[model samples]
Target chain A: MDTAGATRILAVVTPDSGLVGPGGAPVFMAHSQEEQERLALLLARIMGGVPHDLENGVYIVVKHS
Target chain B: MQNHVLTILLGVVAGTLARLVMLRSDYRHYPSYPHGFVTHISLGFIAALVGAVAVPALAKPDYVAATFLILAAQQFREIRNMERETLARIEQTKLVQRGSDYIEGIAGVFEARNYLVIITALATSGANHLWGWPVALGVAVISLVISHLLMQGECVGDIADVVPGKVHFDRSLLMVGDVVIMNVGLPAFREKVLEEGRGVVLKPRDDDARLTLDSIGQRQAILHDISVILGTKIDEKEMEFMPLAKKNADTGEIGIFLLPNEPDLECLVEIIKKVPVIESSKARPLSSYYGRRAAD
Candidate 1:
C-alpha cells in the first residue's frame, strides 16, 4: 500500500484542556497533563507512530515520501 | 476473672463456628479470590465459645484459657489457607500491562502485612488471660483499620498508575479492537474500497494525506483509522493484526504476523474466505492459541 500521501495529526484532549493541536489550535476544553499524555499515546499507537514532534500539547502530522 | 474467661471463650467459639460456616457457604463464589485472615479470626472466636460451653473441662477459667489458645491456632491455619488462595487468584488474574505491576506489588504487600497483624493479634489474645478480651478486641479493631488504609492506598496508587502514565494496551484492548475493526472498518473497507477497487481516503479537513502516511504509513493507516473511531491505544509491542497473509508480494515468502489469541486475524481470515482466490490457500488453526498461557 502506498502510504506516501498519509499525514500524521496529533491532538491532545484532556478534561481540563479540551483539545490542543501542535500549531496553536484553539483549546477546546481544560484538561490535565495525564489526560494529554494518554490522548497523545493513544493517537500515536493508533497511527502506528508519531510523525511530527508534539509540543505544547498538540498533535503534528508528517507527510511520508 | 473466671466469668470474664468464660465470656471470652464463648466469643471465640461463636466466632470460629461462624467462620467455618461462612467459608463453606461462600468459598465457591470466590473460588479464585480469598477472603483473608479476618474470616479465620472470626472463626477462632466462635470455636473458643463452643469449647467453653460444650466441653465440661473448659467450664473452668484454666480450661477457658486453653480453649482460646486452641482456637487461635485453628485461626492461624485458616489464615494460611486464605493466603494461599489469594496468591493463586493473583497469579490467575495476571496483569499484562506495564503500570499494572504496581497494583500487584501493592496488593502483595498489604496482604502479607495484614496476615502478620492478624497472627500477632491472635497470639496476643491467647497468651494473656487477665486482659485478653480487651486486648484482642483492640488489636482486631486496629488491624482492621490498618488493613482498610492499605486497601485505600492500593486503590489510589492503581488509579494514579493507570490514569496519567503511558497507556499500554493488552489482550482486552485487542479483543475490543477486533470487535470494532470487524464491525466498522471491515464492512467499510469491503464495500467502499475492496469491492469497488477504489475509493477516496477521507482526511480531516486541516490534515493532508501525505502527512498522515508519513506518520502512520500504509499498514498503520488501517490501525489509525480504527483507533480514531474506537478511541484506544495499542501498547503491546508484540501484538499485530494482519488482514491478509497469503504470500510476500515481492518474494512470495509466507508472512506470519498472527500470534496466539489473535482473534482479529481470525476475523480477517473469515472475511478473506468469502473471496474465491484468497480462500484457496489452506486454513490456519486459530483456536489452538486460546489460553496458551493460562496455566502459566
Candidate 2:
C-alpha cells in the first residue's frame, strides 16, 4: 500500500470576506475555498481529530480509529 | 672679430651679474616655492635686454646668439625643477592615498563589515599601469571582478562571524523583513484602496484587541483602524493614510509605526524583535541597486 500518498493531505489558507452575523455583529464569512480549508484545519487542531468523508468547502474533523 | 668677441663677453657678464642679483633676492629666501625657475627666467630676460642695449659696439648677430643661449639655459633649468616638483607631488599624493586607504579599511571593518577597500586600491594600482583601449577595458573588467570577489568575501566573512555568535546577538535589527512586507503588500493596497478614492474603516473584533500584522496590507489596515479608533477625523477624500515602515521619529526604537492601539503597537514591536535577520547568500554590486536619477 502507498502509505505516503494515502495519508498525506495539503491545506491552503486564504483571506475571508466580511459578513453580518445573526446578532448583527460583523463576522468574517469563509467565502474563499482556501479559508474553508484553514477553518477545517483550525477546527481539527482544536478538536484533536479529523472528520471522515469531509465536504468540499466545510470544516473537516478527522478521527484516528 | 673684436666686436663679435665683445658682444659674447658682455652677454656673459650681463647674464652672470643678473644671476648674482637673483641669488641675493627672495629666490633663496623662499626655498619651498619654485623660485629657481623665476630666478633663471628673470636673469635670462635681463641679460638679453642689457645685451641688446650694448650691441652698438658689438655685432648684432653675436648678441642675438648670446641672448638665445641664455634663454635656452633658463628653459633647461626651469624644466628640470618642474620635473622634480612633479615627482615630489606624486609621492605626496601616494602617501595621502595610503593613509586614506588605512582609515577606510578600519572603518569598513567596524561600521560596514561587508566592506572592502583593497579592491579599490588594486583597481587604482592597475589603472596606473594600464593605458588606452585594451588596458582601459582590462582595468574595467579587473575592477568589476575584484569588486564582486570583495563583496562575496565580505558577505561570507560576515556570515561566518555572525554564525558563531548568533545566539548572543540580537539579529532582528539586521533583517530586511519590513522591506519584504513593503514590497509584497503596500503597492497593491495603495493602488486598489487609497488611490481609488475609497474610504474604508477597519475596527478590531475586540476593542482591546491589538492586530498583529504579518504583511504591509495588514499594517496599513491597522493604521487606518487606529486613526478611526482614536476619533481622528482624516478626510479620506483628500487624505490617505500612508503606512510608512519606520520607527517613532522622536524615539530611537526601531519598527515602531505611528498607529492606534497602544497595546497592539507594543505587541508588534515584541513580535518583530523575535524574527531573525535575513541574509543574502549571493553577492551583488551596490551600483546595481542604485537608481539612475542624478538628484538621488
Candidate 3:
C-alpha cells in the first residue's frame, strides 16, 4: 500500500452527536454509552478495522491496511 | 580437450551443489510454493551451466563464448526482479507482511547466491584444468564451505536482547513496557488483549543496534516473522488481534505486542531472536568518526 493509503478511518461512532463532525468516514450517532461501544465495534468488525477511543466519547474505526 | 570436458562437468556439479546446500540451510521455509521451488532450482542449474562454461570457454580461447557470460549476468539480475515482484504482489493478501526492506534483502540474496555459484564453478573448473579431478574435487568442497561462510548473515539476537514485557492497559491505551502500542475502544477487546496478548521488548546492545531497531521496516519484519511462526489470532475481520511494534523514544527499545495462537512466550522469544536482520535497516554508527565522537 502507498504511504497515505495504509491507514483510513472507515467509520466513527459517538454517543454525543455534537462531539464529531461529518467528515471523511460515515458518522453513526448512538444514544447511550453501551450503544456507542456496540455500534463502534460492529462497524469495526464490518470494515476490518480497530475501534480507537478518543477518550471524549468518540470512537473511530481505523483500518491499518 | 579431454581435460576441458572434465573441468566443465566438475564445475557444473560443484556450482549446483552449492545452490542446493544454500537452499537447505536457510531457516525460513522460503520458496515453499511448488512453482517457486521449481523456478529456483531451474535457475540454479542454468547459473551453474553458465559458470561452468566460463572457465572452459576462456581456456579454449573462445572470445565469443566469453562474452556469453556477460549475457548470463544480465539474466541473473532478472532473477532479483522476478523474486521482488512475486513477493510484493503476494504481500497484499498477507495479514502480516514481509516489508519492502525484507523483500529487497531476500531478492538481493537470491542474486548473490547465483554469483556464489558462478564463483564456485569457476574455482573448481579452473583447478581441474590446472591440476586434476582429485584436486578439482577438493577445490569444490573447499569452495562450498567458503560460500556457506560468506552467506552466514547476522540475526537480531546478535545485536539485541529480547525480554518479556508487561502487557497492560493504561486507561484505554495498550502499554508494552513504556511504549504505547495503541488505543482500544471496546472493553471486551481490551480484556482479550490483556489476557491473550504477548509483549516483548528488544533492547539494543549499542547505538548502531538501536538505530537498526528504529527502522519501521525492520520493526514490521520482526512482527511479520513472529506472527507467521506462532500463528496469529487475527482473523479476516478481527483486526484487534493484529500484532504491532512500537519504539520507546527515550531508550530506543522496541516493544512488540502480538496475540499468538500458540501463546508460547518462550518459543516466541526464540523466534524473535532468529529474525533475520534486514540488510537495508542495519546501521554502522560506531564505525563513523562523527558517530563515535557523539557516542562519547
Candidate 4:
C-alpha cells in the first residue's frame, strides 16, 4: 500500500567468506568466474525476486510490489 | 466613457509590463529561441489586455462583453498544454532527461504565470480607473512585488541538508554514506567512479521534507540540475554510470553518487542547494494535524 517504500531488498550475497545474504534482499558478491556462474544459476531459480548482475562484479536481488 | 477608455489603456499597459517581467529563459533553456520567447510575450500581452478590459466592459454594463475574459482565461490552459508538449518532445533529446514530473511542474508554472499577469493588469488598470495615474503606478509597484514574491518557490536545500560525502566502495558495492547506490561489476568502472565521482548526502530536516525527498520526481530534478551544471558521465551505453540517488532505508537519508564532468564538490553542493524542489513533490505535512503527529 505504501508505494514510497515499495522497493525492498530481498538479500545481499557477497563473495567474501563468513558474510551472509540478509533474508529480505539478497546481495551476492561473485569472487570467481565459476562462483559467478553458479550464483547466476541459483538466482535464476528464485521466483519472488529479480537478480541483477551489476557489471561491477556483484549481484543484487531486489523484490518489487 | 473617455475615462473608461483611459482606464482600459492603462490596464493594457500595466498588464503588458507584468507579463514581460515574468517571462524569462533560465537554466531549463525553455522558450530557448527568440521565436518561442516572442510567442509567449505576445500571448501574455493578450492575457493582460483581456484582464484589463474586463473591468471596463462590466462597468459599461456590458456584462456580455466581460464574458470574453473567461474565454481568454481558457486559452491560457492551452498555453500550458503547448508548453508541456514542447518540453516533453525536447526532453527526449536530452542526455540526462528531466523526468515527466519536472516537466509538468514547469509547464504548470508557465500557465499560472499568465494568470498572475492577468491579475496584475486587472488590478492596476482598475486602480487607474478609480483613482488616477499616480495611484495606479503605486498599485502597479505593489502588485509587481507581490507577483515576484509569489513566483519564488522552495529549493531542495530549504528543507534538507546537502553535504558532500565520499564516493567509495564497500567491497564491490558503490555507496554514499550508508546508502548502497548499486553494485559495480567492473573493477575498472569502479575505479573510474572513485577517481571522478562525487557524493552528497541529503538529510531531510523533518517528516514533510522526508516525504518530499522520497518523491521520484524531486530526485530526478536534482539529478537533472546537477547534470545541467556539471555535465554527467552518462554515455548511452553506460547506464551503470548514470547518476543515482538511493535512500538509506533505516535513516531516511538520501545519497547521490554522480560522476560529473566537473568534480568540484563545493560547486556541486551549491548547485544541489539551488535546484528547485519539483512542485508536485513538495509536501507540507506541518499544515495538517495528523501530519504534525507523524512528525513528532
Candidate 5:
C-alpha cells in the first residue's frame, strides 16, 4: 500500500546542461526558469513522467521503475 | 478450601473481563477478523489462569506452578513477534501503509496488555485471599481504571493545530496551501486533483511537536488515518492520486493533500486531530536546558 511510485533519477535537466542515454534520449535543457517549468510540464505529459521542481532552474522528470 | 477456590475464580473472571473491556478494534484494525479476536481472548484466559494460580501454588509449595508464569511470559513475547510479522505482511497491501514504527507500537501494546491482564488477575486474587470478596471487587475496579489510563496515548492534537487548507495549482505545480507538493505534468490529472482534492495544514505548537511531525512515519500515519476514514480516491495503480504530506522548510508547518471520497473538510480535520502520535516518533529535545540554549 505504499503510495509513492518506486522512482529514481532517470535524467537531469538544468537551465544550461542536459544528459543523454545510450539510446540518445536527450534530457532537454530549458532556457529560463519559466521555460524549464513549462518544458518539464510538457515532457511530463508526453513521457508520462513525474515532474519534480528542484526549486532552482533545474527540473527532473522521473518515471516509474 | 472454599476461600482458596473463590480467590482463584474471582481473579480469573476479573482478569478476563479486564482484557475484554480494554480490547478495542480502532481505525488501525489490529485485531481485524474474528480469528484475531479469538487468539487474543484465548491468550487473555491463559494469562488469567496463570496469574490466578500463582499465589495458591506458592502457598501449597508447588514451585512448579511458578515456572508456568515464566513460560507464559515467553509465550506473550512470541505473540508480540507474531503480531509484528502479521501486520508487516498486511501492510504490503494497504494503500496507505501503517509504517514500521506504528506497527511495532501496536504489537508492543498487544504484548503489554497481556501482561496487564496477568497483573490484574494476580492482584485481584491476592486481595481476595487476604481480605475476601469485597476487597477483591474493589481491586478489580481499580485495575480496570489503571488499564484504561495505560491504554490512552497522546493524539496529534496534543502536539499540533490542524486547520483546513486549500488545494490549488499554479501552472504545473500542485500547491497545498502555500506548500508546493510537486510539479504535475498532466493537465488532466492536475484538473482532477484540483476539483476533487482536500487539504489540511498541521501547525506544530512547539519545537517538540515540530520534531515529532517531522518524522516520516508520523506524517505517513496522519495520511493513513485520513485515507482510512474518508476513503481515498486512488487505488494501487494510481500512485499519483495518493495522499501526500509535505513540510514547509521555513515555517515548520506541514501541508497534507489528498483526494478523499467524503471530501468533508471538517471531518478530515477532526480525524487529523485524533490521529495518535506514534510513540517512536515523539521527540522532546526542548526538555533539556542545553537544547533550549542551542536553539539560539
Candidate 6:
C-alpha cells in the first residue's frame, strides 16, 4: 500500500514580510507571532494538515499526502 | 486400497492438526475469524490429501493421478497472492499501517506454512508406505516440531539493544534522543505530545543489524506494531500525533516516538524488543567478503 499523498502547502501564516513569496499556496499575513501561530493551527485543523514552523516568524500548514 | 486409506487418513489428520496448532490469533497478528480458520484448514487438508495420495498413486503405477500433485503447486501459489491482496487492501484503512515489507513477509509465511503441511503429509505417508504406522506417526511428530521451530521469526531483541529514551522538543522539532522525528508549530499538539509521548531507541548489535534497521519499511513495521499494541493517539483527521521511528545514521540507532494511549515505557520497550525483524529488510552486510572489507 503505497499511499504517499501529494504534499501541498495549504496555507502559510507569516508575521515577517518578504520572507515568504506567493506561489502555489495562499499566504495569510499576521500582525504578530502569536496570531501567525493561531492561524496556522486553525488552518491545520480545518484542512487536516500539520503545522510546521520555519523558525523565522513563519508557520505553514502542509497537507501531507 | 485399505492400506492407502489408512495412510491418507493419518496424513490428512496430521497436516490439519499442524495447521490448527499454527493458526494463532493474537492482538498484533491477523484476524482469525471462524471463516479464516475454515479456509486455511480446508487448504491444509487438500494439500495433505494431494501429498498423501502421490505416494500410493506412484506405487500403483497411476502416473496421471500422481501428476495431479503437480497441479497442487499452482493452487498453493494462488494462496500467496490471495494473502498479499487481502493484506494490501486492509493496509489502506489502517492509521499506523503495516509496511509493504511486513505484508510481503506475512504473505510469504502463509505460503510457506502450506508447503510445510504438504511436506509433513508426504513424509508421514511415505514412512507408512515404506515401513509401518508406528514409524509414520513418529515422522509426523518430528516434522511438525520442525515446522513449529521454523515459524519462530527473528525479532528486534535478537539483533538490537532496546532502551527507553527521552522525548523532548528541540525548539519546534520533536526529538527522540537527538533523532528528530518531525516538526510541529501547533502549541496544542506540542504540549500533548511532550506530556504523553514515549520514546525508545534501538542500538543495533552490529553492521548487519544496522543495515536492516536502515530500511524505511522495517522502521514503519516497528512503528505500526508498537502503535497496534500500545494504541496510538493519532486519528484519521489529526496527523499531528502520528508516531515516527527515525534513525540516527551516524551510529545506526533508531529513535521511536509515539503517543500511546497508555504511557507505559516498560511495556513499550518489551513490545519494541518483540517486533519481528522484517524479512525483506534484513541485510547481511557482514556475511559477504566485500561488505566486510567496506565496513570500518
Q: Pick the TM-score winner.
A: 6
For residues B186-228, what per-residue lDDT tens digits would candidate 5 score against the true structure? 4567878889899999999988899999999999888988898
Name model 3 segments beyond 4 Å from true: A1-8, A21-27, B25-29
- Report the C-alpha lDDT of model 3 over B104-208, residue by residue, as the tens digit: 999999999999988898899989888988999999999999999988788999999999999999999999999999887898889999899999999999999
Highest DockQ against the true fold, candidate: 3
Q: Candidate 4's residue-wise lDDT over B143-195, tens digit each?
A: 88888788889988998999988788887788998889987654556779899
How does model 4 fare in lDDT?
0.80
Quote each prediction's TM-score. 0.26, 0.17, 0.93, 0.82, 0.85, 0.95
**Model 1 over residues B10-65: C-alpha lDDT tens digits?**
34433343333333223122222354445544444544344334333343536666
Candidate 4 residue lDDT tens string, A16-64: 6355533544456767767765665455345444445554445555554
Write one digit per residue (lDDT tens) for candidate 2, span B118-234.
222223323323332344345445544554443332211121111110011022111122221121111222333222221211221211111122233323332333333332322
Q: Which is better, 5 or 6, measured by TM-score?
A: 6
- Which 10 residues in a row give candidate 6 chain B its minimum summed lDDT? B23-32
Better of 1 and 6 by TM-score: 6
DockQ for each numbered candidate: 0.02, 0.01, 0.75, 0.10, 0.18, 0.73
Fnat measured on candidate 1: 0.00
TM-score of 6: 0.95
Share of reference contacts found in each model: 0.00, 0.00, 0.79, 0.09, 0.15, 0.73
Residue B198's lDDT in candidate 6: 96
The segments of candidate 5 whose C-alpha lies over 4 angstroms from its true place after superposition are A1-6, A9-61
The CAPRI-style docking tier of model 5 reads incorrect
The deviation in Å at residue B11 for candidate 1 is 6.1
lDDT of 1: 0.33
Better of 1 and 4 by lDDT: 4
Off by more than 4 A, model 1: A1-65, B6-147, B150-296
Off by over 4 Å in 4: A1-65
User: In candidate 1, what are the lDDT values of residues A1-65, reduced to their tens digit?
Assistant: 76465542334344444344345322334266555545544554565543232334443322221
Q: Write the number of the candidate with greater lDDT, choosing between 1 and 2.
A: 1
Clashing pairs counted in every model: 47, 6, 0, 20, 1, 2
- By DockQ thresholds, what CAPRI class is model 1? incorrect
When only the first chain is scored, the TM-scores of the models are 0.42, 0.39, 0.85, 0.49, 0.61, 0.85
